[model samples]
Target: MSDRSPAQHSDMLLFLTDEQLRQGIEAMFFAYQGFTADPDRILAGMAYGRAHHRAVHFINRAPGTTVNNLLGILGVTKQSLNRVLRTLIEDGLVESKVGRVDKRERHLFLTEAGAELERKLSDAQRARMRAAYRDAGPEAVTGFRAVLEAMMDPNMRRKSSALKESST
Candidate 1:
């Protein structure tokens, strides 16, 4: 198998059974449910959904990030994001300011309330992940990250890589 030619890649599908594929699909579903469980509970009390959570998280990660920058990071339609932004802004959770260099552009920042909420939401997930990582050990965590990166679609992969670069 290790010595297979380039043409062998096309025929690789023949080796995978339908049952194996179904099992993989089921694993992803259950894993995602577990991943969202903690944050979902926190959001339930606040009348917010995953969209709001993501916006808060990103704004917290990059203070004074432009609306366009966030749109690219989130891959969401502008109207949809505008709705979320409106709610957050009205609720005093987030602030939008005119860009210093480009006055037409809106820059996003989380207010004290937004920061507190984001911390609460992230802390819940971090506690779960910290325990899981501790149990899985360092190598397993590395492999998990590698698998997730490999599974990303091309557009998402590009965005992910960009975010990783910006963080450094």
Candidate 2:
């Protein structure tokens, strides 16, 4: 707790200039575009967009999540989510069933085809991430993840942490 002097800490804070911050912002934009490129191509073939990918990803991550839970996680309007859900269900990629204990609640699950698609999409992204992480090295990867977590809203951060915990 008493390692660094005040002057040293101030010097480090001053190192992050406005221009440096802007560069970091631009880097993030390009990185995100590159990250999504492969999945975009695959989704384009199926006429689906990033929304569909997100829904599939989250549903695969949480097999028995409810629509209300998804809505909270996704931060999308009911109408918007309904449109995406409808298409996925119609395509047989997602199956929604009434909750056994709560008749009014709809629980979402990925069908076999849906799981296959999720695997394909995730595999592409994971490969890109693996390569990026390898190139960045472990220290940079840890910093990158910490920065990402810090950028998330408090509620989203909690949700992300919960999901990470559950997956493990």
Which candidate should be chosen as best, given lDDT against the real structure? 2
| Ten-residue stretch with the least lDDT total in model 1 | 159-168
Candidate 1, residues 50-103: lDDT per residue as tens digits? Answer: 999999998998888887778888889999999999999999999998877778
- Candidate 2 differs from the real structure by a C-alpha RMSD in angstroms, to one decimal, of 3.9
How high is each candidate's TM-score?
A: 0.83, 0.89
- Residue-level error in angstroms, candidate 2, position 44: 0.5
lDDT of 2 by residue, 49-133 (tens): 9999999999999887888888889999999999999999999999998888778788889999999999999999999999999
Candidate 2 structure, TM-score to reference: 0.89
Candidate lDDT scores, in order, read 0.86, 0.90
